[model samples]
Target: MQVLTAVPQVLSYVVALVDEVPEAKDVKAGWLAFAIFIGLILAVAFLGFSLVKQLRKAEAAEEAGLYDPSDKKPTPMPTVEPDRKDDTAQNGA
Candidate 1:
């Protein structure tokens, strides 16, 4: 397309304009950004350590029989005995 072809010329003109401009001020990231960056790194490291610890704990719990296996048959639920009910009250004694 013609637009794509004109992009290089426009970019060259922009580069020339930028080259003519003088540096006004020097900008720095400063200490606050550096502190926040370090804090984030420490947080991520802490989270990674916590994740590994919890995973180890879960594995230990599983080994100690906390988690039941799927292949084994489940225990039957307790049934209510019909004989234990008050028959007279049900019959409007």
Candidate 2:
């Protein structure tokens, strides 16, 4: 029938239109993903450079006698306690 043929043609046109005009959400999502990937790569490179610089500084300090290994001593970490209110009136005990 002519109706069936017209339906297929309409569907094809719709498909073509949809393919031509992309949605804003899809474009935004792709840009966000690209930005995140680039940011992650930059952060990793910065961290690696920072680590290398710190290592070099430490080595230079050691060579200059800034740190003495023979006189090194271990120190204990301090502990902190949280303060709580004593509810003696509520318990009545």
Candidate 3:
């Protein structure tokens, strides 16, 4: 487990080594930047999804508890339009 923790440090050192070589410096920086950008995007997306899921779970728990539903207003579900060529026809146009 301790060895696993040192992987990032080892990888960083390898990148640093490549960066020291004039011919490989640009490649090193580009790869490093790409990896960081992808990691950031994934982190943000995961965090946002986790937060929404937690909120939903909390709401469900509240609904199942000894609390009056009328006391707290529930969030409305958004209306989604049907994806039909003739919307009226689908709904008896």
State candidate 3's TM-score.
Answer: 0.41
Alpha-carbon TM-score of each model against the true structure? 0.52, 0.45, 0.41
Q: Rank the candidates by lDDT, best first.
A: 1, 2, 3
* Tens digit of per-residue lDDT, candidate 1, span 9-72: 9999999988876455666578999999999999999999999999999989878888878744
Rate residue 86 of model 2 by lDDT. 77
By TM-score, who's the top model here? 1
Each candidate's lDDT (Cα)?
0.88, 0.87, 0.86
Q: What ranges in model 1 sit over 4 Å off?
A: 15-25, 70-93
Model 2 / residue 19 / CA error / Å? 24
* Candidate 3: RMSD to truth: 18.2
Could you give candidate 3's per-residue lDDT for residues 7-88 as a string of tens digits? Answer: 9999999999887655654554578898999999999999999999999998888878856768887799999988668778
For residues 14-73, write the lDDT of model 2, one tens digit per residue.
Answer: 999888776777665578899999999999999999999999999899888998878666
Query: Which pairs of residues clash in candidate 1, taking residues 3 or more apart in a chain or in different chains?
Result: none
